[model samples]
Target: MNKFNGNKFKMDYSQFKTEVSKRRRSAATRELTKIAYSTPHSVISLAEGMPNEETFPFTEISIKLNDGSDFVLEGNELAAALQYIPSQGFPPLLQVIREFQRKAHAPPLWDSREVLIVAGGQDGLSKALEAIIGPGDPILVQNPVYPGVNVVITPHNAELIPIEQDDYGVIPICLRKRLQEREASSLKMPKIMYINATGANPTGTVMPLERRKQIYRIACEYNFLILDDDPYHFMYFTDEAPRSFLSLDTEGRVIRLDSFSKVLSSGLRIGVITAASPLVASIELHMQSSHLHAPTLSQVILYKLLKIWGYDKMMEHFRRIRSFYKERRDLIVKVAEEHLLGIAEFSVPSAGFFLWIKVPGIEDTWKMVMQRGVTHGILVAPGAAFMADTSKPCNAIRASFAKASYKEMNVAIERLALLIKDELAKNRSILNGNT
Candidate 1:
């Protein structure tokens, strides 16, 4: 892709790549491996120093499913699983995910698009940030952003400008207004905008289709890429999912990170990045120097599981997982409303596992949640953890219902209500004393 530069044309999105990424080169042996794998069976004599599979002790790997069914990995499959594969991903697994993404996202530039398998969603997100953000670069992030993203951004010394969000997720007007204001300011314009699109972390608010379209339109106008970090895509409580930024990205300005963590086993550490070919290639080069590739064993297992389940069955499994979390969402909301009805306020989460609650009297949830709530034998994420500026106070708290039982949730909320009241009374007393 080329952009008009006055009279001449220059590389367009290539500007999004940082100096660090531009300097990164694929490992020599890893590059050879790609060629070796692609050549005809008769052409491979021996170039790279790959280990002999005969020395591997494992003969087979047998996995038992919850339904008493099982699958065995042996012979050639076991050998491939035991060895290091291409940085892009194991071919078979990559094909399956591409098919899934096509069906799921229907990215507009499918032919020019590429998918790279990553160790996890966080790994993909971190690498993507590293590939683009240079020192002192300006980056736009959703307010109360994911802490993992903050960890990545901090090391780069990137200036994070927060975009305000509401029940429908990021407010389009707020984003547009911020950009308009930024034009007159001395701050450098941002090249990337990070968003958690579906079932956003901490808040559990999903961006509506219209809002996603609006955001994408703004990205096009501003000439910035949208980093759609959608780990909770399958965990949505709605009957149908809103259109993704990728689906609406006609200009290939959306770089989406999809994860198997929420709907599948997080421990497996499997994620995928779908973007334009060059962007995916740059990230793949970074992978070559880091962890060679996502765990081959995990990829093989996931590949086998998906093959046995097929596309239709896999989707059925997703529906079942959604139903399970939906039930939990209902329980948590009911309990919270019953206990903290008037003392505090919260929007019932439309997706994800968290309930973002606001306690009007509490100036900062750090003390209430980290100190008091912990003492009460209740555990919840403090809202400060998600803020762009952690030094500042946050009025909200994040309570997750993913693991707690109905009784435990009830007890937690009940205890939380007491904590809120106690804090409120103490604040009132302090104000009265000052006066």
Candidate 2:
């Protein structure tokens, strides 16, 4: 044996596990594991924010290859699934996204504006925040907002100023007042105003067109960047969907994010960010450094689909998806009316995947739902997860109808109603000094 040769030694790899940041030690991470292990047979998983994969048109997908054999790829879009191509994504895909936005929003023609593809809407949001928001910079968001943005904001050391919101997404009056307050106090003005605009998360509220115009005006007045994170824009069942903030944005202050996760397949991880050329250029640079680029295969596949199906065909597909979700929403609302209306309150969502339910006398609804209701074979996302401050107690939970079948949904609703009733009874008992 040579001098340095043969002794068996165990490498000390323990240090790798200890290097996690404090922010990573979140309750959400723990809750995710718990959710994974618990199997509810009547599991109406109103928790998954993703689209129902069953609705994707498997038959319409086809891939043309240079080889003699035309591959169907499991009777699905396989060529697009297998290939690895570009970082900025395929040009054809970008064209499709741009065209989609144009038809949906009817924005004025801008020669310099373009789209930058990323992994998903969340990825785009993270990159956009990184490009614009420096550490400790104030960023404005609605009080009860999507938790995805909060996950990124916390780690980056950015201050999230929670603006109160009413039924119309992100009340314009609150935003204006907050900006004025910040100005008067010489506080750091918000660099970005993150709004869901179309269908807000948890709240299920849609902003009106007039409100969009008002928000755009305030954004211009305050000189703050407006990040319109709209994934559910196309999911509106009503004929009167709100006008996009991007269309109303005359100033170069809006960065609009769109995702195929809700409409198409979430696994593809495809989303696009549209903005002024300069801002997009910066975001592109950031993307190149971070993810290199969004997968080329997905882009190519999407381009093919768009080319064949065209915009009208795609809109019809979305309308079908909307009808499916709308029916589910109606069913859930009916159950809530029968079982939960007097006991609990909720705003009817016109579009998107969630219903925000508020239950009285229950502080820490998240803990109660996970520990109690989850054990009872029912699951729901607590409202506290959406808030920036988890220390504060929340009385609400978010219920989604996107994943569950109708029969399963009924069982879950019945179970959830019982849980709420029990909790309410316990609260009453305590107040009456019977506990």
Candidate 3:
């Protein structure tokens, strides 16, 4: 060992710096270094990564306190909102979310599961993907899955084997068949199975209890983990609440993503991941390095809401929210039945924002959306967007009733019906010409 300045420790600037992996370095590194640590008082700078005070607009925000008095957010607290805080989150808020999770799932005490606050479900999922998946690793997904999820898996260069889904969500036989087939392939079998489960994206089919049990069994049999992405869990129209995979996971093989985007407000961007503590710790380390943490301000805001509302009051709030969505679901279904039902069959949509409708004659939605949806002033999400392979055939379209006004929903279905008619007419002409 060599020492400088005749001491045990030597100040070698080069030695002080440890090497970062090539993967850890990104295009952002250069951009982050371009900013000044302390701006001059005379020269006002606007290159910071925060919104302007005028844009923030709110000096004081208030929420009802426990006894119904207003709890105001301003002064130093407001400043804290603008400043950075803990990477885990605001300390008190993390505890609040922990309480919420315990009440929501009631997972066994011995299980050693925990929650990590995230920007949203997508953020939590991305971290999970990074933790569990890598190049050439195979991940199982429900076919006709959420396209965003498909996109997430793409950069990893991981193999995606899709399990088929019926009205009740993923079919057991299809899952088994795919697993068995993959077993024979030279490629590595899928080590993780992902599903939207509650109010599945696009399809809006809630995975029934028995189906979930069957899915858990399959995961056990295959010795794989389950990534249950259930954003619409609280939005269920059914009388009883759906059980989460976290509740069923005895051996800690499931990682669940829950979101407040739908239940609370989309802009809030607060989400939670409940999984075995070990997995949560791994994902947390990723969060610490990447995002550092979800916005501390948002977590503090959510904490106030939860504290004032409490568990029972929060449940009441959720009930009203669920009821509102149920009404929209009913109206949208009625509109579809009146105009587009015969032309395009769709599931009743027991939960979630969208109705996944299939047009019998159409082979793909890209053309259908172009010719009918746009021309008729009814924009739709092509089912192909949700497919694992976008090039695969997609006859379905996803229409969300959440943001659409009642009149828009009604008129949109009428336009869809007309579009279907045109496609049918074209098909008939082709058949006649062939004859």
The best candidate by lDDT is 1
**Between candidates 2 and 3, which one is better according to TM-score?**
3
Model 2 alpha-carbon drift over 4 Å, by segment: 1-86, 433-435
Candidate 1 clashes between residue pairs 3 or more apart in a chain or in different chains: none
* lDDT on C-alpha atoms for all candidate structures: 0.87, 0.74, 0.76
Clash number by candidate, in order = 0, 1, 0
lDDT of 3 by residue, 224-270 (tens): 88999989998998777899888787767788898889988778898
1 or 2, which is superior by TM-score? 1
Candidates ranked by TM-score, best first?
Answer: 1, 3, 2
Candidate 2 to native Cα RMSD, angstroms: 15.2
lDDT of 2 by residue, 330-370 (tens): 98888878778577888888779988899876876876797
RMSD of each candidate?
3.4, 15.2, 9.0
Please give each candidate's TM-score: 0.95, 0.81, 0.84
lDDT of 1 by residue, 71-167 (tens): 9999998999999888989889989998999998787758778889999999999999999999999999999899988899898889999989999
lDDT of 3 at 35: 31
